[model samples]
Target: MSERATPVKPTEEQEREQSRETERPSDGGADAAGPGPNADGATATEPVTTGAEAVVRALENAGVEYAFGVQGGAIMPVYDALFDSEIYHVTMAHEQGAAHAADAYGVVAGDPGVCLATSGPGATNLVTGIADADMDSDPVLALTGQVPTAFVGNDAFQETDTTGVTTPITKDNTFSSDPDRVGSDVSEAFALAREGRPGPTLVDLPKDVTNAVTDREPDEPRVPDTYHVQEEADPEIVEAAARRIEEAKKPAMLLGGGVIKGNASDVCREFAIEHEIPVITTMPGIGSFSEDHELSLEMAGMHGTGYANMAITHCDTLIAIGTRFDDRLTGGIETFAPDAEVIHVDIDPAEISKNIHADYPLVGDAATVVEQLREAVETSPKAKKWRAQCQQWKSDYSMAYEVPEDEPVQPQFVVEALDEATSDRAVVTTGVGQHQMWACQYWTFTEPRTWVSSHGLGTMGYGLPAAIGARLAADDDQEVVCIDGDGSFLMTIQELSVAVREDLDITVAVLNNEYIGMVRQWQDAFFEGRHSASDYHWMPEFDKLAEAFGAKGFRIDDYDEVADTIEAALAYDGPSVIDVHIDPQANVYPMVPSGGDNGQFALTEDQL
Candidate 1:
């Protein structure tokens, strides 16, 4: 006899089945003769399966080797299944962190990253990260637990209508009403999240469905056609774009995240060099073009360098690739590149005229479009004036490192030291606000997708979890560093446990200033130091918190300690948190101060 596992204790409904087999459910029960054939020649399968088993089978079928999420009552079954399977689940401190981590994972892996969260608050907390992925078009799958289906509309404990809440945010949303279909739902969710115009997708599961048992067999998921994008780009549109580039005298390239997503960085760089044109990147496209390249200008828009903004404004022809012109980058659309004749090339057709109008719209894969552009530009004359203009701009506003000769430790110094120590090869994730902006300005990333941050969403507390995901996705030899603010670090500080549990040797450098630095900076600048209670002098010691979570911790008081602390953290086998105290009253200058006019910056007599 085949060795039968112990029968699961039946529910009261199943007890009635024991008395009369005929009264059992019609779908898949103990007495059903295999499965009935459906209209498509496929057999009708059981609709009841453990949520944990479904999660594992679905992930395996989706070819996902790992995911990141925190374990809670609603998500424990999925976690248990992950534990049993070959797949690794890196537990994190908060749901938003996991989502950001998933975004980073997608950036490096070039595939949809998966994240999980419990019901109610857990799902709600992931909204910001979801919105981030949505705005940036990052492929991410978020699984959330829900109260049992029977109690879904009753506001049961820890339950929320996650499907309803995430519907507008996600590309698609689904709830598991039947256990047998859970794997299929997950497969579709992953496919929809990754294919065509990538974004976030949600799959909500009920608590009881996770624990309940049924006569169900897991099967490999099939990829459906619904998720794929239209393959053809308009030939007429491509020809028009080629014509524009050939005729233009002052053409420039504006690279964005889509190039990275399409792995077209090499193609973009080649095109830029061949035409002798300048390349200005969005925040997401920082590492796409080498900072050392003469034709590569800094990022444009708010927080961008002055030279980049000026170059974009003066360019007669703009070749925008793989990016939507976000408002933050455009400074209110009307005044953005108004004089430039834009050639918008993107994989997503919806992004063509969503914000800024495009004179020549080329819709296709970024890599494919770059290849076409390369072919088209083979005969075009080199634009020497454009190259000279770009060089002059770079030379004019070359990123300056200004500091007092005998000043105490500055946040920029820490970033520079960390960059030097890591040989500038590490993937840096950052929390939102001024420190994040500082890292962007200070760090010189040499490779594409090296910086993982929530640019569009601007979510705080995104650094640690994103670093965790980056470490998992990147080469085993490379280190992952998190640049966090004291306020941001404390918000999701519990993620240290995940790093410890998984033995991920990641480092978090906390720029502590005993206050919410960004808000405090605003208060110091515009609000006249009203402060509004941004101080957190009584906050828990980060060193102690790291120790509590089974990781190493250190405090850096002197400038010399920055490199050593980072080195020690990188060398350690477990996670580490380094808390560095900076001047609490310091502010990030070059301030527009909200409502200020362009090119009007407050020059500080001395940068603190």
Candidate 2:
């Protein structure tokens, strides 16, 4: 697995120097060269670049550095064109890995991540990752190849309706039939993915269209101002929200993924600090505010911190910011914030009343709305009492688990050790399940864009690929960690080849509990402990598997070795996997059963 060098386009000064050299005459003549006509009798102002070249150039203009995918027959034209472009093409073992990696790249890079795949199975394989991006509102551009235009309706080999398959999962989908339009279509796809309420966008390229020769030059990349239009809350609505906050005795704020997307952490923090309001977050909104902040209540609902759930349940006025109050966070609509008057602020108007009713709806960007509210809001007299109560709850209902000195390692302990090792600089990603919840619960994310997970889709095998993407998008010095479970890790474990081949600096900590831990836990709590197919009688030796894939691997069972193993994995120059044998029977505590209200959490063994 050798690394490839893909240099970025030279700076403007370098371009000018190259142009001067090219235009200079070898004979030192007065006239060097003039525009000439081609065989088509058109003035040759610029060399004819193919549609495939146009697509690659457009992506470069848009500041894209990498494109992830597995190549196939229909998509070979784009790969051929990529040889001359600055963008690095990452070849993955599976198309699904490419899609997940691209999705995670979009989340960490603050730009639309690009992924390419072929028609038929390749396009179908991208559906899960596209759905994940749509559910989480991450911006990703999915490009797929199609059968030649003439044979598209004839059901040519390897042909499928790429646009139709991706329509529902993407923000927008389009098919290109004309070679000349590929550049502009690709540009629009990126814009749609990144505009208000960011999501995945799909562009299907016909095989002939990419291979066709075209004289049309690529369109200039759309300016950010053309699409990233920010909406500000109306003054009246802002004032009304402030008035509601002032009137309430006990007020709390619910932060969601929108805050991170809108980059409103600083303003959100200021608003909370000035108003002395307690803050809680949704699963996708974990890092919007620092968990260590004095006013922060961490996560709320389902597997959220007990105090945060209690705070939301008891607050008189609930200010929901950049969040959609999904079922996981709300539990039951009728019981969620039953007594509180809700004031919702979001960039998307549809989300305002989609879930929980908003007594005062401010349809605008979260950062802009928070800034306005900060200017108009005043400290309430009851804030002091509410703050004291929240602090007490945090102290009394802290997330706790007892680790027997002689028993197998607990999953939570592994997360704690990893957190201590990373020191908040690592971008943490997780697959859906117990490992996901434990990572969210135990890791202290002090900054935005540091925590990535498939929240809405809850896709298994998302951790490793997403971590790979995050590492590629992040600064060279930044560390990336994937907290995975045995069940989820195996789903797309083949992605280890990409990580190892690229020499990415990533640490994968596998909580090797030999069962589908979440399902088994649910069975124990709700179904009389009937394991069914949840148990894994045979498991792969992950350390050996890692070594076979050309990466470092470690297997640890003793609790005392967890910290040292994690530190060594992080210190390794290339990708490494630390497989810790965790207690299979260990269950994630402080859970709110399905349809249960925030206040009705199952806390202990007695409750189970």
Candidate 3:
């Protein structure tokens, strides 16, 4: 894989320079040249600039150093401009990779990630990733080049309504056929993506717009404050929610990814402590509640900690903050916490009661709403019984199944070894599968924003690229680990090159079970124990592949060596792969078969 010439490692002085550049006057005109008259009586025959230059210049002004995309016929001009400029462009094997990488980059960098593709199929391929960003409230700017304006809507070669296709999923979208509107439209798209309650946005640029000459002086785009959501909390609604909290016997806080997104964990913790309530988080919300906190119930729903699930099952009142109660967190929605009266708070109005019912729908920012709720709940006495019950549940169901032998080969053992070796400090990204579940179950995330995985999107091959993006975003001297399964690793295993060339300290921890673990588990529990197509018949020696990439590699068959190997991998200065072989029969327990309700979960091998 060819690498970019200049990696984005800015010094402190460079940071200061970038900051000053942001504050500098926004003159969009390309340094006074081209068709304009010169001070002397000489005619300048320089090439005329176009709207595409202005759009690209705005990206540079925003400190966008990289763009991910797969170039197509309609997008060739934009790609040409990008290559000619100082911005780095990464070619992706699949547009999904581009979109996901961009999404991860945004999450890690706290800015809008840029992605580009052409019309029709190329643009369609990015739909899933765009939707992922939309659902997660991630900041991503997706640009798709359209067919010539005159040829649009006639089913011209490679033409599709990219904006129309993305409008439902994107926070905002625009289509620009006029050459003059490209810069402002693209600037608006990027600004909208990074504003309050950030999300993905799209700008469809016609081919003619890219090639058309613009003699008019480019105006630096203005960023309006309208993109941010207003914080307007109704005192009456806050009091009603508080009164419900005050009157309840068993109240538990269901923390979602939204809490982290809104940076409302402090407020959440304040409310929890003030009201003496326990917290149960969703998979994406794993780190929102501190694991060290006495009142924290790590996770809730299918594959969640047993204590977390039971707390949700038994709680009398549920205060859901910054969460939409997705199916994974609810098991089956119909039977989830039938006794609890739900109080939902979110910035988006449509999310209040979309899936699960909310007894109190207070639409506002999580931080503001939670602060108000905290103020109202300042007088509630501590509920000793409720906290004690939650603690008992945590003590009972939260324990990990013991790896019986000194040479035991359990996924839990591998994850535990990695956790112990790493001290749970690094940002861990996981591919979607049984390994992902195991990481969620056994790996303790002590800090917020340290765990990244495909929770809602559930996309395979997310771990490696996500880890790569994370390391890039860290921009510091810190290690990142990609916990992957065999099936998921094979999806985009080519990303190993990215880690090697960039020399990122990323360890690929492959929990090799010789099977697609999740589907196999499903088959064993519900499909009458028939394995069918779930088995991975054969796999390459991953260690050899890692060595081929000019990186260190290790294969651990004995569980006793797991801890030492993980530590060694961490000590390595560059990327390394640790393939840990484990039992194929091992499956994450407390499984609720698809379509089954909460009580329908299988607890032990006897139930299986």
Q: What is the C-alpha lDDT of each candidate?
A: 0.75, 0.84, 0.76
Best by TM-score: 2
Error of 2 at 361 (Å): 0.7
* Winner by lDDT between candidate 2 and candidate 1: 2
lDDT (tens digit, per residue) of candidate 3 on 1-608 = 12222134454546534532442222232211222244453321232277676567667656776677888988776775564344556566678778877887787677888889988999998998899888778889998988998998899999888888898999888887766767767777888887667799998888889878775433444456555575756789888888888888888999888887777878888778766789888887777877778888887777777777777887888999888788877877888888889999888887888988888888888898888887787467346898898899777765568676754388888887787776445778889999999898888876667777777778888888777766666555445788999998888788787667556677899999989999998887778889998889697778888999887899988866887888888788778998888888888877765545665566774674
- Residue 41 error, candidate 2, Å: 23
- 446: Cα error in model 3, Å: 2.5
TM-scores of the candidates are: 0.86, 0.92, 0.88
- Candidate 3's C-alpha runs over 4 A off are 1-48, 84-87, 153-157, 215-230, 406-408, 423-425
Residue-level lDDT of model 1, residues 1-608, one tens digit each, is: 11111111123534423422332122221112212343344322324247567766788667786677766778777765554443445556778878888888987777889988989898898888888888778889999888878898897888888988888889888988777777678888887887777789888988777767744654454446655665445777777787778877778789998888778889899888877778888889888888767777767666777667777777778999988988657765666776789999888888999998998888888888778777665466457777777778667766675666466678888888888888556788898877888788778877887888888877778888887778768765577888999888877787777667656768888888888888877776667779788887977788778998988999888877777787887676668888888767656654433433224333341322
TM-score, candidate 2, is 0.92
Q: How well is each residue in 437-529 modelled by candidate 2, as lDDT tens digits?
A: 999999998888999999998899999999888987876556789999989999999999888876777899999898999999998888898
Higher lDDT: candidate 2 or 3? Answer: 2
Ranking by TM-score: 2, 3, 1
What is the C-alpha local distance difference test score of candidate 1? 0.75
**RMSD in Å for model 3:** 5.7
